[model samples]
Target: MREFDYQRLVIGYHGCDASVRDKVIQKGDQLQASPKRYDWLGHGIYFWEHGPARALEWAKEQKKRGKLKTPAVLGAVLHLGSCFDLLDAEYTDMLAQAYPLFVDSTKAAKKTLPNNRPLDASDKDQLLRDLDCAVVNWTIEEFEKDGTAHFHSVRGVFQEGLKVFPKSGIHRRSHIQIAVRDPACILGYFQPPSKR
Candidate 1:
């Protein structure tokens, strides 16, 4: 059987308020996991993989929304241990399998399945990922029930925003993101040199 552990270290950037960054880097405070139902990769501390610029952009947007006072980026060294990597066929197939189970569970509980919706009313990108988040959370819970190895992180690629060029497949905001469920997988935090 193929071990799911990725083993290699990768850098991730988290966009947040400047005060939050200061507390994490200067005071050694940990980043709290987001438990929002619409989280793209489920309840975890999320980061943009190797995309500081994009992270900063997100933070700036958040600031505009009054979520933060000043935008900043906090860099992290991460090990994607036993990750549920959506980029791979194996995991995507598993996620597809999990969808029906998730729906069944919802129906059993007399709850309706949630839908993914655009954050902005007219946007094509479904930024509010309620359905995706629910499915991922359900799949992970099922894995735990089966006594399978725990997934420390969930990683996925998102093609978002407007196309980079006319008829181009690439999106301007496309990026790979990681949601770290295991705090231990985060080796250290740093101030990205570019911004220093």
Candidate 2:
């Protein structure tokens, strides 16, 4: 079990339209937004941890897809506030326990578990992470119901793309992600310093 300094605050960066960023800044907080059914990390405001360039890349891609007229990166200072960190063994153990419960719940409901798959044969940047998302959400739900703990956010490091070396866990596109379930964890939002 590796030790983590959960006490330390971290910065998070989000990619979105310039208009959206402006609205959030003007409002002094992020507007309430529903989580997408296909959200990669199960229903929260998503940010790329320490990956401003990745955020910008996503923004540009959104612009190219006509989803955003003016792409921008929004930065935030985050206090994790009871984080469910996947990188840690404690959380992973909780998840491991939750998986069986999740499976049983889905089976009882007569629904198949959502399975993850590649977004496309050639697309390495995105994966269909529905299954992982579902399990995490289920775990949170169970915890809330039992009054054991309330997680304000979930954090994880995902290793994407080709590995940096043979038998290495590190990847060319690895990045940390933070999903803030509670808006209060976001201390404040700012425009990327470079953008200003």
lDDT of the structure predicted as candidate 1? 0.92
- Taking all chains together, each candidate's TM-score versus the true structure is 0.95, 0.88
**Count of clashing pairs, candidate 1:** 0
Model 1 lDDT at residue 52: 97
lDDT (tens digit, per residue) of candidate 1 on 1-196:
2344678678999999999999999999999999999999998999999999999999999999899999999999998888899999999999999899889999999998999999897779989999999999999989998998589999999999999999999999999999999888898999987654
Report every candidate's CA lDDT: 0.92, 0.83
Error (Å) of candidate 2 at residue 95 is 0.6
Worst 10 residues of 1 by lDDT: 1-10
Residue 147 local lDDT, model 1: 97
Instruction: Return model 2's CA RMSD, one decimal.
Output: 4.2
Error (Å) of candidate 1 at residue 64 is 0.6
